[model samples]
Target: MPEGTPELSAKDLRTLIPEYEGLALATTLLNPEPGEPGVRESSLGGPLLWPADEPWPYCAQEDHWTFGSDLRNTTEIVAGTVPTVPILQLFARDVPGLEFPEGKDLLQVVWCALNHEHDPGPVMPLLYWRNEAEVVAGGLLSEIPVAGEGEYDEDHMPEPSTLSPTPTDDYPSRHDLPEDVRDTWEPRFRSPTSGGVMWPSDSNVIATKAGGWPAWIQPADWPDCDGGHRMEHLLTITGDIQLGDCGGVYFFHCRRCPGLPWDWRFDCH
Candidate 1:
């Protein structure tokens, strides 16, 4: 390795990682605020910049996930031996969808920041948090309790004395913001927009294609409310991933996958 070597581009990652061929190029049309600068549409998110010392609990019997390199590196980094950089914002709100509303992603994030911690899929906001980057900036998203009643006190902080367990007669639906709390959560995550090629890669995602035909997965065991179909999730690719024979756990980070571009010269000179 050279001293001035640059970081690996998403294209380069495809080659370094095996089993890359099993991926489908699913595009997430991010509904960031209009005219927002630096937010690139059709952009691919990948190569999750994890911490050397992961704050997550022990999964199975294995040690926690190492942020950057090896244990020595993670320790050095944590003990102020290695430099610490501000964690970047790598996660999007929703699991990429067609016309997926703006505040929806934030709603999911807020929900994660507020209530649900681990595997928040089937329970809260109907979303998943596997590869989504923990919102590190606002300290909103932290390692959710791997077990039990969660650990954060922000969302759980007791409200005003009057805000008790007793519920009012009713509440509002569509929120108009400063207008009223009732209408606030009304229009957020409306039933996922149906019709058209919404989720081409989702196993449970059901949508009518260009030919007025439904497409998605259907099985007897699939869970549902009204017996509807369910789409599968984009999975993380984990195996004996080795970076120069020193194995590094590999996860499927979607960088628009250029069909698993084999190793490139990199030097654009």
Candidate 2:
């Protein structure tokens, strides 16, 4: 719902709320630079085609749960230097009426490792990829093993960097809404800041932090599967471009649920 966008009227939301149940909340405005036409953008550590023989994803949580312990004095494993700003990327097959799962394609990447010292308690480092080319040619020749390695300090490993796509006019807008959410759904949806709104549940007005973006409070249920059904609303993932607050990272799926390890779900706020 990106170009022009403005169609929400189930009789003007049943006249503001006569038990309205048409469910209206939509937004999809992401342009991760580099030829933006249909999601193929990058940022968090910019530059990816990775597979130089895999093995670059480290957390090894001990107490380094969410960017604590001086996060290796701001990454590159101790600031040996290499990250030129990049902390979020969203691509669920370029989003635009997402359905996915049938050749599989999805990617949500995020990374932030610059703390200097205090107030750096929101360490960002999230990755989820499920591109299929025969499951990446059978897991790109295996080499996975590095979790908690004797408790940190190998220079505090945390590699996997390269992302490019920096173009911004600060997209996502509904003109700074928040006057009680434009007095409750602004006469029937269209202002969760324009490019952000999807409510099947998880109430939402945005407020959830931890590497930010992910809020789906209240019985948003429908993310546990056994192939019963119900779980579809793919696309939200907004922290805009990362720094701190401004939540939203909701994604769900269940194309008909079969393989792909129980469809998808990346709830946030």
Number of the top candidate by TM-score?
2
For 136-209, candidate 2 gives per-residue lDDT tens digits of: 46454243333332222222232323233222111112322234544675445554556634222222223211
Candidate lDDT scores, in order, read 0.21, 0.37
Worst 10 residues of 2 by lDDT: 165-174
State candidate 2's TM-score: 0.30
TM-score versus the correct structure, for each prediction = 0.19, 0.30
lDDT of 1 by residue, 1-269 (tens): 22333333334323442322223234322222222122211111111223334543212211211222343442111111111111112233323332222332321111111222232211111112323233333233233332222222122221111100111111111110123322432243122443121111222112111111122122112122222333222221111111121111111212233221111000000
User: How many pairs in model 2 have backbone atoms within 3 A of each other, for residues 3 or more apart or on separate chains, i.e. clashes?
Assistant: 16
